[model samples]
Target: MEKLILTRLNVLGHPGRMAVFRLLMRRLPDAVPAGEIGQALAIKPSTLSVYLSALCGAGLIGQRREGTSILYSARAQAGGEIVDFLFNDCCRGRPETCAPVSRVFREGFPDMSDRKYNVLFICTGNSARSIFAETILRDQAGERFDVYSAGTRPYSQLDPFALEVLKAKGHDISGLRAKNVSEFCAPDAPQMDFVFTVCDQAANEECPAWEGQPVSAHWGMPDPVKAEGTDAQKSLAFQQAYGALRNRILSFTALPLDSLDRISLQKAVDDIARETPEVTT
Candidate 1:
Protein backbone atom coordinates (compact mmCIF):
# COMPACT_ATOMS: atom_id res chain seq x y z
CA MET A 1 0.00 0.00 0.00
CA GLU A 2 1.19 3.53 -0.74
CA LYS A 3 0.94 6.37 1.71
CA LEU A 4 -0.83 9.57 0.54
CA ILE A 5 1.20 12.75 0.80
CA LEU A 6 0.27 16.43 0.30
CA THR A 7 2.70 16.56 -2.60
CA ARG A 8 0.93 13.62 -4.23
CA LEU A 9 -2.38 15.45 -3.61
CA ASN A 10 -0.98 18.59 -5.17
CA VAL A 11 -2.74 17.61 -8.36
CA LEU A 12 -5.77 18.93 -6.45
CA GLY A 13 -3.82 21.99 -5.32
CA HIS A 14 -4.62 24.12 -8.37
CA PRO A 15 -7.17 26.90 -7.90
CA GLY A 16 -9.48 25.42 -10.55
CA ARG A 17 -9.29 21.97 -8.97
CA MET A 18 -9.94 23.48 -5.57
CA ALA A 19 -12.99 25.24 -7.01
CA VAL A 20 -14.31 21.97 -8.36
CA PHE A 21 -13.65 20.29 -5.01
CA ARG A 22 -15.44 23.06 -3.18
CA LEU A 23 -18.43 22.58 -5.45
CA LEU A 24 -18.45 18.85 -4.74
CA MET A 25 -18.13 19.47 -1.01
CA ARG A 26 -21.13 21.76 -1.15
CA ARG A 27 -23.10 19.01 -2.86
CA LEU A 28 -21.68 15.83 -1.31
CA PRO A 29 -23.52 12.50 -1.59
CA ASP A 30 -25.07 13.78 -4.82
CA ALA A 31 -23.17 13.40 -8.05
CA VAL A 32 -23.11 16.43 -10.31
CA PRO A 33 -22.68 16.03 -14.04
CA ALA A 34 -19.53 17.41 -15.66
CA GLY A 35 -21.51 19.52 -18.12
CA GLU A 36 -23.21 21.49 -15.36
CA ILE A 37 -19.93 22.11 -13.61
CA GLY A 38 -18.47 23.37 -16.86
CA GLN A 39 -21.42 25.62 -17.52
CA ALA A 40 -21.57 27.13 -14.06
CA LEU A 41 -17.89 27.91 -13.84
CA ALA A 42 -17.60 28.76 -17.55
CA ILE A 43 -14.65 26.43 -17.87
CA LYS A 44 -14.19 24.38 -21.02
CA PRO A 45 -15.34 20.78 -20.58
CA SER A 46 -11.83 19.45 -21.34
CA THR A 47 -10.37 21.69 -18.64
CA LEU A 48 -13.09 20.87 -16.11
CA SER A 49 -12.64 17.15 -16.72
CA VAL A 50 -8.96 17.42 -15.88
CA TYR A 51 -9.80 19.09 -12.57
CA LEU A 52 -12.54 16.56 -11.80
CA SER A 53 -10.11 13.77 -12.53
CA ALA A 54 -7.62 15.27 -10.13
CA LEU A 55 -10.27 15.32 -7.37
CA CYS A 56 -11.37 11.75 -8.08
CA GLY A 57 -7.74 10.64 -8.22
CA ALA A 58 -7.06 12.20 -4.83
CA GLY A 59 -9.95 10.19 -3.28
CA LEU A 60 -11.69 13.44 -2.42
CA ILE A 61 -14.62 12.76 -4.75
CA GLY A 62 -16.65 9.81 -6.00
CA GLN A 63 -18.41 9.00 -9.26
CA ARG A 64 -21.46 6.98 -10.35
CA ARG A 65 -23.08 6.13 -13.66
CA GLU A 66 -26.67 6.96 -14.50
CA GLY A 67 -27.55 5.86 -18.01
CA THR A 68 -25.21 7.91 -20.22
CA SER A 69 -24.27 10.45 -17.58
CA ILE A 70 -21.58 10.32 -14.90
CA LEU A 71 -22.28 12.07 -11.59
CA TYR A 72 -19.76 13.22 -8.99
CA SER A 73 -19.89 13.85 -5.23
CA ALA A 74 -17.51 14.38 -2.33
CA ARG A 75 -16.41 11.27 -0.43
CA ALA A 76 -17.94 11.86 3.02
CA GLN A 77 -14.98 10.99 5.28
CA ALA A 78 -12.39 12.46 2.93
CA GLY A 79 -14.45 15.65 2.71
CA GLY A 80 -13.61 16.58 6.31
CA GLU A 81 -9.93 16.10 5.69
CA ILE A 82 -10.08 18.52 2.77
CA VAL A 83 -11.82 21.05 4.99
CA ASP A 84 -9.24 20.74 7.80
CA PHE A 85 -6.43 20.95 5.27
CA LEU A 86 -7.77 24.28 4.14
CA PHE A 87 -7.63 25.71 7.69
CA ASN A 88 -4.87 23.71 9.43
CA ASP A 89 -2.47 26.64 9.53
CA CYS A 90 -4.74 29.07 11.32
CA CYS A 91 -3.11 31.32 14.02
CA ARG A 92 0.33 30.42 12.60
CA GLY A 93 2.82 28.71 15.02
CA ARG A 94 1.44 30.48 18.11
CA PRO A 95 -1.83 28.57 18.57
CA GLU A 96 -2.14 29.99 22.08
CA THR A 97 -3.43 33.21 20.53
CA CYS A 98 -6.70 31.33 20.00
CA ALA A 99 -6.97 30.40 23.70
CA PRO A 100 -9.62 33.02 24.48
CA VAL A 101 -11.84 31.58 21.74
CA SER A 102 -11.17 28.02 22.94
CA ARG A 103 -12.19 28.78 26.50
CA VAL A 104 -15.63 29.92 25.37
CA PHE A 105 -16.72 26.49 24.07
CA ARG A 106 -15.01 24.64 26.93
CA GLU A 107 -17.48 26.37 29.25
CA GLY A 108 -20.25 24.63 27.33
CA PHE A 109 -23.11 26.13 25.31
CA PRO A 110 -25.88 28.35 26.72
CA ASP A 111 -22.92 30.56 27.53
CA MET A 112 -24.46 33.52 25.74
CA SER A 113 -26.02 34.86 28.97
CA ASP A 114 -28.72 36.45 26.89
CA ARG A 115 -31.33 34.18 25.33
CA LYS A 116 -29.72 31.80 22.85
CA TYR A 117 -28.22 33.69 19.90
CA ASN A 118 -30.95 34.02 17.30
CA VAL A 119 -29.77 33.20 13.74
CA LEU A 120 -31.70 33.98 10.56
CA PHE A 121 -30.64 32.56 7.20
CA ILE A 122 -31.77 34.55 4.17
CA CYS A 123 -31.79 33.90 0.45
CA THR A 124 -33.58 35.05 -2.67
CA GLY A 125 -35.75 31.96 -2.53
CA ASN A 126 -36.32 30.15 0.77
CA SER A 127 -36.55 26.79 -0.99
CA ALA A 128 -32.94 25.60 -0.69
CA ARG A 129 -29.79 26.49 1.24
CA SER A 130 -31.43 28.87 3.71
CA ILE A 131 -34.03 26.30 4.67
CA PHE A 132 -31.44 23.52 4.79
CA ALA A 133 -29.23 25.53 7.16
CA GLU A 134 -32.19 26.33 9.41
CA THR A 135 -33.14 22.68 9.91
CA ILE A 136 -29.65 21.17 10.17
CA LEU A 137 -28.30 23.71 12.66
CA ARG A 138 -31.41 23.50 14.81
CA ASP A 139 -30.89 19.75 15.03
CA GLN A 140 -27.13 19.86 15.70
CA ALA A 141 -26.89 22.99 17.81
CA GLY A 142 -29.62 21.63 20.11
CA GLU A 143 -31.04 24.28 22.44
CA ARG A 144 -27.93 26.38 22.38
CA PHE A 145 -28.91 28.45 19.32
CA ASP A 146 -32.18 29.88 18.16
CA VAL A 147 -32.38 29.15 14.43
CA TYR A 148 -34.75 30.63 11.81
CA SER A 149 -34.73 30.82 7.99
CA ALA A 150 -36.41 33.05 5.42
CA GLY A 151 -36.03 34.49 1.92
CA THR A 152 -35.77 38.00 0.57
CA ARG A 153 -38.59 36.89 -1.74
CA PRO A 154 -39.89 33.41 -0.99
CA TYR A 155 -41.30 30.70 -3.17
CA SER A 156 -44.67 29.13 -2.31
CA GLN A 157 -43.22 25.93 -0.83
CA LEU A 158 -40.02 24.28 0.30
CA ASP A 159 -37.90 22.61 -2.39
CA PRO A 160 -38.74 18.91 -2.40
CA PHE A 161 -35.08 17.91 -2.38
CA ALA A 162 -34.47 20.17 0.62
CA LEU A 163 -37.40 18.58 2.41
CA GLU A 164 -36.23 15.08 1.54
CA VAL A 165 -32.67 15.69 2.81
CA LEU A 166 -33.92 17.08 6.12
CA LYS A 167 -36.35 14.18 6.53
CA ALA A 168 -33.58 11.69 5.71
CA LYS A 169 -31.43 13.33 8.38
CA GLY A 170 -34.25 12.85 10.97
CA HIS A 171 -35.17 16.50 11.07
CA ASP A 172 -38.91 17.09 11.30
CA ILE A 173 -40.01 19.52 8.59
CA SER A 174 -43.73 18.82 8.94
CA GLY A 175 -44.51 22.43 9.75
CA LEU A 176 -41.64 24.11 7.95
CA ARG A 177 -42.51 26.38 5.03
CA ALA A 178 -40.96 29.08 2.87
CA LYS A 179 -41.11 32.50 4.50
CA ASN A 180 -40.21 36.04 3.44
CA VAL A 181 -37.54 37.96 5.32
CA SER A 182 -40.05 40.80 5.57
CA GLU A 183 -41.78 38.78 8.25
CA PHE A 184 -38.70 39.03 10.41
CA CYS A 185 -38.06 42.66 9.61
CA ALA A 186 -41.57 43.63 10.61
CA PRO A 187 -42.10 45.93 13.56
CA ASP A 188 -43.12 43.05 15.79
CA ALA A 189 -40.25 40.77 14.81
CA PRO A 190 -38.02 39.22 17.43
CA GLN A 191 -34.58 40.72 17.80
CA MET A 192 -31.84 38.81 15.99
CA ASP A 193 -28.27 38.13 17.10
CA PHE A 194 -26.97 37.18 13.67
CA VAL A 195 -28.24 37.33 10.10
CA PHE A 196 -26.65 35.30 7.28
CA THR A 197 -27.26 35.60 3.55
CA VAL A 198 -26.85 32.24 1.87
CA CYS A 199 -27.03 33.31 -1.76
CA ASP A 200 -25.09 35.91 -3.77
CA GLN A 201 -28.12 37.89 -4.95
CA ALA A 202 -29.51 38.30 -1.46
CA ALA A 203 -26.10 39.19 -0.11
CA ASN A 204 -25.77 41.98 -2.65
CA GLU A 205 -29.34 43.26 -2.66
CA GLU A 206 -30.21 46.37 -0.75
CA CYS A 207 -32.75 45.79 1.99
CA PRO A 208 -33.80 47.32 5.23
CA ALA A 209 -30.92 46.89 7.62
CA TRP A 210 -31.52 44.62 10.61
CA GLU A 211 -32.97 46.61 13.51
CA GLY A 212 -30.81 45.28 16.30
CA GLN A 213 -27.72 45.73 14.16
CA PRO A 214 -27.27 41.97 14.32
CA VAL A 215 -23.84 40.83 13.25
CA SER A 216 -24.10 40.02 9.55
CA ALA A 217 -22.29 37.37 7.57
CA HIS A 218 -22.42 36.19 3.97
CA TRP A 219 -22.23 32.40 3.72
CA GLY A 220 -23.12 32.05 0.04
CA MET A 221 -23.98 28.64 -1.38
CA PRO A 222 -24.75 27.59 -4.93
CA ASP A 223 -28.49 27.31 -5.51
CA PRO A 224 -29.02 23.57 -5.47
CA VAL A 225 -32.48 23.82 -6.91
CA LYS A 226 -31.01 25.54 -9.96
CA ALA A 227 -28.90 22.47 -10.64
CA GLU A 228 -29.75 20.90 -14.01
CA GLY A 229 -30.29 17.15 -14.01
CA THR A 230 -32.70 14.36 -13.19
CA ASP A 231 -34.55 14.27 -9.85
CA ALA A 232 -31.86 12.13 -8.24
CA GLN A 233 -29.10 14.39 -9.56
CA LYS A 234 -30.75 17.44 -8.05
CA SER A 235 -31.30 15.57 -4.81
CA LEU A 236 -27.55 15.12 -4.68
CA ALA A 237 -27.26 18.87 -4.77
CA PHE A 238 -29.41 19.19 -1.65
CA GLN A 239 -27.30 16.62 0.16
CA GLN A 240 -24.14 18.53 -0.67
CA ALA A 241 -25.66 21.78 0.53
CA TYR A 242 -26.63 20.08 3.77
CA GLY A 243 -23.10 18.80 4.30
CA ALA A 244 -21.54 22.23 3.78
CA LEU A 245 -24.02 23.90 6.11
CA ARG A 246 -23.46 21.23 8.72
CA ASN A 247 -19.70 21.74 8.54
CA ARG A 248 -20.01 25.53 8.90
CA ILE A 249 -22.49 25.31 11.77
CA LEU A 250 -20.30 22.81 13.61
CA SER A 251 -17.39 25.26 13.41
CA PHE A 252 -19.61 28.11 14.55
CA THR A 253 -20.97 26.28 17.59
CA ALA A 254 -17.50 25.08 18.52
CA LEU A 255 -16.07 28.60 18.77
CA PRO A 256 -15.20 29.98 22.18
CA LEU A 257 -17.02 33.34 22.34
CA ASP A 258 -18.27 33.59 25.92
CA SER A 259 -15.31 35.36 27.49
CA LEU A 260 -14.01 37.46 24.60
CA ASP A 261 -14.68 41.17 24.38
CA ARG A 262 -16.68 42.40 21.39
CA ILE A 263 -13.49 43.03 19.38
CA SER A 264 -12.16 39.57 20.10
CA LEU A 265 -15.55 38.08 19.43
CA GLN A 266 -15.64 39.83 16.08
CA LYS A 267 -12.22 38.43 15.21
CA ALA A 268 -13.36 34.94 16.18
CA VAL A 269 -16.37 35.30 13.91
CA ASP A 270 -14.09 36.40 11.08
CA ASP A 271 -11.91 33.39 11.76
CA ILE A 272 -14.95 31.15 11.55
CA ALA A 273 -15.84 32.67 8.19
CA ARG A 274 -12.30 32.32 6.86
CA GLU A 275 -12.14 28.79 8.16
CA THR A 276 -15.51 27.77 6.64
CA PRO A 277 -15.21 25.28 3.83
CA GLU A 278 -16.15 26.44 0.33
CA VAL A 279 -18.96 24.45 -1.25
CA THR A 280 -19.87 24.26 -4.97
CA THR A 281 -23.54 23.31 -5.32
Candidate 2:
Protein backbone atom coordinates (compact mmCIF):
# COMPACT_ATOMS: atom_id res chain seq x y z
CA MET A 1 0.00 0.00 0.00
CA GLU A 2 2.80 2.43 0.91
CA LYS A 3 4.64 1.61 -2.32
CA LEU A 4 1.51 2.24 -4.40
CA ILE A 5 0.92 5.58 -2.65
CA LEU A 6 4.52 6.62 -3.20
CA THR A 7 4.33 5.65 -6.90
CA ARG A 8 1.11 7.63 -7.35
CA LEU A 9 2.65 10.68 -5.70
CA ASN A 10 5.77 10.41 -7.83
CA VAL A 11 3.70 10.14 -11.02
CA LEU A 12 1.60 13.18 -10.04
CA GLY A 13 4.70 15.17 -9.22
CA HIS A 14 5.23 15.84 -12.95
CA PRO A 15 3.16 18.70 -14.48
CA GLY A 16 2.35 16.89 -17.74
CA ARG A 17 1.44 13.61 -16.07
CA MET A 18 -0.70 15.39 -13.46
CA ALA A 19 -2.67 17.20 -16.20
CA VAL A 20 -3.37 13.93 -18.00
CA PHE A 21 -4.44 12.30 -14.75
CA ARG A 22 -6.83 15.18 -13.96
CA LEU A 23 -8.45 14.94 -17.41
CA LEU A 24 -8.98 11.20 -17.10
CA MET A 25 -10.35 11.61 -13.58
CA ARG A 26 -13.10 14.03 -14.65
CA ARG A 27 -14.73 11.31 -16.82
CA LEU A 28 -14.42 8.50 -14.29
CA PRO A 29 -16.48 5.33 -14.86
CA ASP A 30 -16.52 6.29 -18.56
CA ALA A 31 -13.34 5.41 -20.40
CA VAL A 32 -12.28 8.20 -22.78
CA PRO A 33 -10.57 7.39 -26.02
CA ALA A 34 -6.79 7.93 -26.12
CA GLY A 35 -7.13 10.36 -28.99
CA GLU A 36 -9.53 12.49 -26.95
CA ILE A 37 -7.10 12.54 -24.03
CA GLY A 38 -4.20 13.56 -26.25
CA GLN A 39 -6.29 16.20 -28.00
CA ALA A 40 -7.47 17.62 -24.67
CA LEU A 41 -3.96 17.93 -23.20
CA ALA A 42 -2.30 18.87 -26.50
CA ILE A 43 0.62 16.60 -25.57
CA LYS A 44 2.72 15.11 -28.31
CA PRO A 45 1.98 11.42 -28.96
CA SER A 46 5.47 10.17 -28.00
CA THR A 47 5.60 12.22 -24.78
CA LEU A 48 1.99 11.35 -23.83
CA SER A 49 2.83 7.68 -24.33
CA VAL A 50 5.66 7.91 -21.76
CA TYR A 51 3.41 9.68 -19.22
CA LEU A 52 0.58 7.20 -19.73
CA SER A 53 3.02 4.31 -19.21
CA ALA A 54 4.24 5.90 -15.96
CA LEU A 55 0.70 6.37 -14.60
CA CYS A 56 -0.40 2.91 -15.77
CA GLY A 57 2.72 1.37 -14.22
CA ALA A 58 1.84 3.04 -10.91
CA GLY A 59 -1.74 1.63 -11.17
CA LEU A 60 -3.18 5.14 -10.90
CA ILE A 61 -4.67 4.84 -14.42
CA GLY A 62 -5.99 2.00 -16.54
CA GLN A 63 -6.27 1.28 -20.28
CA ARG A 64 -8.89 -0.83 -22.04
CA ARG A 65 -8.91 -1.91 -25.65
CA GLU A 66 -12.33 -1.10 -27.09
CA GLY A 67 -12.24 -2.51 -30.61
CA THR A 68 -9.69 -0.37 -32.49
CA SER A 69 -9.69 2.49 -29.98
CA ILE A 70 -7.64 2.34 -26.80
CA LEU A 71 -9.62 3.90 -23.92
CA TYR A 72 -8.13 5.41 -20.77
CA SER A 73 -9.64 6.33 -17.38
CA ALA A 74 -8.43 7.02 -13.88
CA ARG A 75 -8.32 4.05 -11.51
CA ALA A 76 -11.27 5.19 -9.38
CA GLN A 77 -10.46 3.16 -6.27
CA ALA A 78 -6.85 4.24 -6.26
CA GLY A 79 -7.74 7.85 -6.99
CA GLY A 80 -10.17 7.92 -4.06
CA GLU A 81 -7.50 6.59 -1.75
CA ILE A 82 -5.06 9.29 -2.82
CA VAL A 83 -7.74 11.95 -2.29
CA ASP A 84 -8.44 10.57 1.19
CA PHE A 85 -4.76 10.60 1.97
CA LEU A 86 -4.45 14.24 0.98
CA PHE A 87 -7.52 15.20 3.01
CA ASN A 88 -6.43 13.26 6.12
CA ASP A 89 -2.78 14.29 6.16
CA CYS A 90 -3.18 17.88 4.96
CA CYS A 91 -5.89 18.73 7.48
CA ARG A 92 -4.02 17.04 10.32
CA GLY A 93 -6.48 17.23 13.21
CA ARG A 94 -8.56 20.05 11.64
CA PRO A 95 -11.30 18.00 9.94
CA GLU A 96 -13.35 21.07 9.02
CA THR A 97 -10.57 22.31 6.70
CA CYS A 98 -11.08 19.47 4.26
CA ALA A 99 -14.83 18.94 4.85
CA PRO A 100 -15.85 21.22 1.99
CA VAL A 101 -13.47 19.48 -0.42
CA SER A 102 -14.97 16.11 0.50
CA ARG A 103 -18.51 17.35 -0.06
CA VAL A 104 -17.65 18.86 -3.44
CA PHE A 105 -16.30 15.59 -4.81
CA ARG A 106 -19.07 13.42 -3.38
CA GLU A 107 -22.04 15.60 -4.37
CA GLY A 108 -20.84 17.27 -7.57
CA PHE A 109 -21.81 14.22 -9.58
CA PRO A 110 -24.81 12.48 -8.04
CA ASP A 111 -25.36 8.76 -8.66
CA MET A 112 -26.79 8.27 -12.17
CA SER A 113 -26.64 4.48 -12.29
CA ASP A 114 -30.17 3.89 -10.97
CA ARG A 115 -32.39 1.46 -12.85
CA LYS A 116 -33.81 3.01 -16.00
CA TYR A 117 -37.32 4.45 -15.80
CA ASN A 118 -39.68 3.93 -18.73
CA VAL A 119 -41.49 7.12 -19.77
CA LEU A 120 -44.16 7.86 -22.37
CA PHE A 121 -45.09 11.27 -23.81
CA ILE A 122 -48.53 11.68 -25.34
CA CYS A 123 -50.26 14.30 -27.52
CA THR A 124 -53.35 14.63 -29.70
CA GLY A 125 -51.69 13.21 -32.83
CA ASN A 126 -48.24 12.06 -31.57
CA SER A 127 -46.72 13.98 -34.43
CA ALA A 128 -45.19 17.29 -33.34
CA ARG A 129 -45.49 18.01 -29.62
CA SER A 130 -45.31 14.45 -28.26
CA ILE A 131 -42.51 13.39 -30.58
CA PHE A 132 -40.42 16.41 -29.65
CA ALA A 133 -40.91 15.77 -25.95
CA GLU A 134 -39.99 12.11 -26.33
CA THR A 135 -36.78 12.78 -28.23
CA ILE A 136 -35.68 15.59 -25.91
CA LEU A 137 -36.12 13.49 -22.77
CA ARG A 138 -34.38 10.53 -24.37
CA ASP A 139 -31.44 12.59 -25.52
CA GLN A 140 -31.10 14.40 -22.20
CA ALA A 141 -31.15 11.37 -19.87
CA GLY A 142 -31.06 8.16 -21.88
CA GLU A 143 -28.89 6.64 -19.14
CA ARG A 144 -31.73 6.84 -16.64
CA PHE A 145 -34.86 6.78 -18.79
CA ASP A 146 -36.31 4.68 -21.59
CA VAL A 147 -38.58 7.09 -23.47
CA TYR A 148 -41.50 6.56 -25.91
CA SER A 149 -44.14 8.77 -27.57
CA ALA A 150 -47.78 8.09 -28.50
CA GLY A 151 -51.02 9.85 -29.42
CA THR A 152 -54.77 9.59 -28.83
CA ARG A 153 -55.30 9.70 -32.62
CA PRO A 154 -52.19 8.37 -34.27
CA TYR A 155 -50.75 10.02 -37.39
CA SER A 156 -49.95 8.12 -40.56
CA GLN A 157 -46.37 9.38 -40.44
CA LEU A 158 -43.99 11.47 -38.34
CA ASP A 159 -44.40 15.23 -38.69
CA PRO A 160 -41.69 16.70 -40.92
CA PHE A 161 -41.37 19.75 -38.67
CA ALA A 162 -40.62 17.65 -35.59
CA LEU A 163 -38.08 15.60 -37.50
CA GLU A 164 -36.34 18.67 -38.88
CA VAL A 165 -36.11 20.41 -35.53
CA LEU A 166 -34.90 17.29 -33.69
CA LYS A 167 -32.27 16.53 -36.33
CA ALA A 168 -31.14 20.15 -36.28
CA LYS A 169 -30.66 19.85 -32.52
CA GLY A 170 -28.53 16.68 -32.94
CA HIS A 171 -31.08 14.17 -31.66
CA ASP A 172 -31.26 10.62 -33.01
CA ILE A 173 -34.34 10.45 -35.28
CA SER A 174 -33.70 6.83 -36.28
CA GLY A 175 -36.69 4.52 -35.64
CA LEU A 176 -38.83 7.41 -34.38
CA ARG A 177 -42.44 6.87 -35.46
CA ALA A 178 -45.88 8.16 -34.66
CA LYS A 179 -47.59 5.51 -32.51
CA ASN A 180 -50.99 5.22 -30.84
CA VAL A 181 -51.71 5.36 -27.12
CA SER A 182 -53.73 2.11 -27.43
CA GLU A 183 -50.54 0.16 -28.04
CA PHE A 184 -49.52 0.89 -24.46
CA CYS A 185 -52.95 -0.08 -23.09
CA ALA A 186 -52.52 -3.63 -24.43
CA PRO A 187 -51.69 -6.49 -22.06
CA ASP A 188 -48.00 -6.82 -22.95
CA ALA A 189 -46.83 -3.20 -22.88
CA PRO A 190 -43.77 -2.21 -20.87
CA GLN A 191 -44.74 -0.66 -17.54
CA MET A 192 -44.19 3.08 -17.42
CA ASP A 193 -42.72 5.13 -14.56
CA PHE A 194 -44.07 8.43 -15.88
CA VAL A 195 -46.47 9.64 -18.58
CA PHE A 196 -46.73 13.23 -19.84
CA THR A 197 -49.32 14.73 -22.17
CA VAL A 198 -47.73 17.38 -24.36
CA CYS A 199 -50.96 18.83 -25.74
CA ASP A 200 -54.08 20.22 -24.04
CA GLN A 201 -56.39 17.95 -26.03
CA ALA A 202 -54.65 14.76 -24.98
CA ALA A 203 -54.38 15.87 -21.37
CA ASN A 204 -58.10 16.67 -21.17
CA GLU A 205 -59.24 13.53 -22.99
CA GLU A 206 -60.60 10.58 -21.04
CA CYS A 207 -58.30 7.67 -21.84
CA PRO A 208 -58.02 4.07 -20.74
CA ALA A 209 -56.14 3.40 -17.52
CA TRP A 210 -52.41 2.73 -17.80
CA GLU A 211 -50.93 -0.60 -16.66
CA GLY A 212 -49.08 0.76 -13.63
CA GLN A 213 -51.29 3.83 -13.26
CA PRO A 214 -48.04 5.70 -13.82
CA VAL A 215 -47.54 9.19 -12.46
CA SER A 216 -49.07 11.36 -15.18
CA ALA A 217 -48.59 15.05 -15.85
CA HIS A 218 -49.53 17.64 -18.46
CA TRP A 219 -46.71 19.51 -20.21
CA GLY A 220 -48.77 21.14 -22.90
CA MET A 221 -46.92 22.80 -25.78
CA PRO A 222 -47.97 24.36 -29.08
CA ASP A 223 -48.46 22.03 -32.05
CA PRO A 224 -45.86 23.25 -34.51
CA VAL A 225 -47.13 21.08 -37.37
CA LYS A 226 -50.58 22.68 -37.03
CA ALA A 227 -49.23 26.18 -37.52
CA GLU A 228 -50.71 27.82 -40.68
CA GLY A 229 -47.93 30.07 -41.90
CA THR A 230 -45.11 30.53 -44.38
CA ASP A 231 -42.21 28.05 -44.44
CA ALA A 232 -39.97 30.29 -42.30
CA GLN A 233 -42.75 30.82 -39.71
CA LYS A 234 -43.40 27.05 -39.57
CA SER A 235 -39.71 26.37 -39.02
CA LEU A 236 -39.63 28.85 -36.13
CA ALA A 237 -42.71 27.27 -34.55
CA PHE A 238 -40.99 23.88 -34.48
CA GLN A 239 -37.89 25.42 -32.96
CA GLN A 240 -40.05 26.99 -30.25
CA ALA A 241 -41.67 23.68 -29.38
CA TYR A 242 -38.27 22.01 -29.28
CA GLY A 243 -36.95 24.67 -26.89
CA ALA A 244 -39.97 24.34 -24.57
CA LEU A 245 -39.67 20.55 -24.31
CA ARG A 246 -35.92 20.78 -23.80
CA ASN A 247 -36.43 23.13 -20.85
CA ARG A 248 -39.02 20.89 -19.20
CA ILE A 249 -36.90 17.77 -19.70
CA LEU A 250 -33.96 19.48 -18.03
CA SER A 251 -36.18 20.40 -15.08
CA PHE A 252 -37.36 16.79 -14.86
CA THR A 253 -33.79 15.52 -14.79
CA ALA A 254 -32.93 17.84 -11.89
CA LEU A 255 -35.51 16.26 -9.56
CA PRO A 256 -34.54 13.79 -6.83
CA LEU A 257 -36.67 10.90 -8.02
CA ASP A 258 -35.33 8.52 -5.39
CA SER A 259 -36.16 10.81 -2.51
CA LEU A 260 -39.65 11.87 -3.59
CA ASP A 261 -42.76 9.78 -2.98
CA ARG A 262 -45.57 9.23 -5.46
CA ILE A 263 -47.67 12.19 -4.35
CA SER A 264 -44.70 14.52 -4.13
CA LEU A 265 -43.31 13.27 -7.43
CA GLN A 266 -46.65 13.79 -9.10
CA LYS A 267 -46.80 17.37 -7.86
CA ALA A 268 -43.20 17.93 -8.86
CA VAL A 269 -43.80 16.60 -12.34
CA ASP A 270 -46.93 18.69 -12.71
CA ASP A 271 -45.15 21.78 -11.43
CA ILE A 272 -42.52 21.44 -14.18
CA ALA A 273 -45.06 22.40 -16.80
CA ARG A 274 -46.34 25.33 -14.80
CA GLU A 275 -42.93 26.71 -13.87
CA THR A 276 -40.79 26.13 -16.94
CA PRO A 277 -39.69 29.15 -18.99
CA GLU A 278 -41.90 30.21 -21.86
CA VAL A 279 -41.19 28.99 -25.40
CA THR A 280 -40.27 31.35 -28.25
CA THR A 281 -38.92 30.95 -31.74
The C-alpha lDDT values of all candidates are 0.72, 0.78
Top of the candidates by lDDT: 2
Tens digit per residue, CA lDDT, model 2, 1-281: 66688789999999999888876654433466767677767888999999999999999899989899888877767877877777777776355788665554433322336668889998988888888888888878888899999999988998887788888888889979989898998888888878887775565455566764566776776688788889889898889988888888999999998776554676688678778885855
Evaluated against the true structure, the overall lDDT of model 1 is 0.72
Candidate 2: which pairs clash?
none
Tens digit of per-residue lDDT, candidate 1, span 243-264:
8888888887886757655545
The TM-scores, one per candidate, come to 0.58, 0.59
Q: Which stretches of candidate 1 lie over 4 Å from their true place?
A: 1-111, 279-281
Query: What is candidate 2's TM-score against the reference?
Result: 0.59
- Candidate 2: which stretches are off by over 4 Å? 1-114
